[model samples]
Target: MSESFNWHKAVTKKWDQNVAFWSEKSRSMWNEGSRSGIIPFVKRYVPVGSQMADIGCGDGYGAFLLSEAGYDVTGVDISPKMIEHANQISGDRLIFKQGDLAELPFEQHTYDGLMAINSLEWTEDPKHALDELYRVLKPGGRLCIAVLGPTAGPRQNSYRRLYGEDVICNTMMPWEFEQLASETGWRTLDGYGVFKEGVKEDVSHMPKPLQQALTFLWVFMLEKQ
Candidate 1:
């Protein structure tokens, strides 16, 4: 197999092994932060009753929040263990499925909006994954994505130490991320830095000097053109 495939496999295995730990941790804190940090930003662009996909939706907490907010939500993750836990909470308007970010299972133009919070950075090919997300979204649909930024710092280093050198994580500067969105046929509607309390729109696009000054997770709102 290719190096990329092996790296992805290792990442998936690591998540599978830690699903229980992550599930507990998510419920304790991460879920609450997401509700305050990203959910409201997403809701502003995607109205109720729209179909939405929560890509890389571990344990489905984010998806559940979107569902409760009135969207028909589908949560997808590569880890079967995560999907299994997610399915426990699934219902009429919420569906959880095991799937890869680079190859989403849905048909073209299937969703009105999609969110891939903290997930794309782990993909072997972020550009390919972005393309896949673009394909599945209906024309003019919105996408909200969050990924590790330059500020990932020690947390990222610790992952390499724990998961081995082959583990994949690709972080980009704010301008690079904006350019990627433009190249992939998505127009940047808004972008921000996500904090534990809420989202900040200050870091959307930055010069190299300013980019170097900021060290935080990035959340972007993009629209298909």
Candidate 2:
């Protein structure tokens, strides 16, 4: 982290500028693309009608999916524009709020589960972000999270930091993120790799390490301990 850099400002600015693009693609993503599996995956552990908080919920599509799947949902994002776009869609069981991951605006033990897709890396402090997630969930609450793999193209946001530039994204690899989550008091219940279309293979028979090594993204199911 840079001492004088404004991380929150830069992150919000970046997402605000892309709200239109995100809104255009979010529906397909949650319905039939890379995120299609998340709702079902979470459903396996978090029962229907449970309260869920969707962190980094861009354009609210993922949160909509959660609501449609029968979970009462609240979607939160750092970018006001993203929240605005998310708010355009209304659901009896869903709502949107603008809030940062490191300091979510919610009471302790407020939710039964939380979902955060590609959000943790956007924070400057992964541990602190994880702690906040822990604080808001009830004991034994489920957490369904996804982190970009080592080769994911979206990780370019952190590339400029090598030359002394201040960047909002963190280059935390899948395994490293798992370790961090473990150290931060989350117990892993299950995890699997999500590869790009052409990269999918029968890696289920392989070792867990090898499976995640070839992923475009790794999704984990954890419980607050």
Candidate 3:
């Protein structure tokens, strides 16, 4: 992260400007084939009727899906415009709020499960963000976090090109993230990678090298211990 970078201002501006594009993209993906892998993983791991938080939930489509699956879901994002768009579609079991990931607005032990999909990679302080997530989760709460890994070269470059050097796309290595999780009182259940092209594959069972070579995103399932 750059010393002079204003993460909140920069991220907020970017998302506000692109919220319309993203809202449509999210809707299309949710309705089409993009969420096939994620939905299954969520169904298998997160029990029905659990209180869940979708951190960095842009446009709230993922939260909508989780609510449909019987989770009482709260979608949180830093972008006010994104939250506004999400609220327009909110229902009985789903709501959207504007909040920073490093300093979530909820009280302690508030959620039974949480997800941070494609979100943490842009955080200025991911460790603090993870700490906040740990603080809000009840004991044994499940967390499904997907982040951009180092291999997402094109995506990283795009951010730099569009935003400038100060706007960083911080990709984490698997081992680094695993260590952070361990230190933050989380027990890892599984770790895997998914490709950027939306291909449905079970690369979690493959070796680390092979997985890294093939995928751009890393997904981790963990339990708060």
Best by lDDT: 2
Instruction: Return the TM-score for each candidate structure.
Output: 0.84, 0.96, 0.87
lDDT of 1: 0.79
lDDT of each: 0.79, 0.91, 0.81
User: In model 2, how large is the Cα lDDT of residue 135?
Assistant: 97
lDDT (Cα, 0-100) at 99 in candidate 2: 100
Worst 10 residues of 3 by lDDT: 154-163
lDDT of 1 by residue, 68-120 (tens): 88999999999988898899895678999999998899999999999998787
TM-score of 2: 0.96
Q: Write the per-residue lDDT of candidate 2 for residues 1-225, one digit (tens) a residue.
A: 667788889899999999988888888877887788999999999999999999999899999989999999999999999998889898999999999998999999999999999999999888999999999999999999999986678889889888988788886888999999889899999987878766756878998777777787899999999
At residue 180, what lDDT does model 1 achieve? 87
Query: Which lDDT tens digits does candidate 3 get at residues 57-117?
Result: 9989888988988889999999999998888885789989999887899999999999888
By TM-score, highest first, what's the ranking? 2, 3, 1
Better of 1 and 3 by lDDT: 3
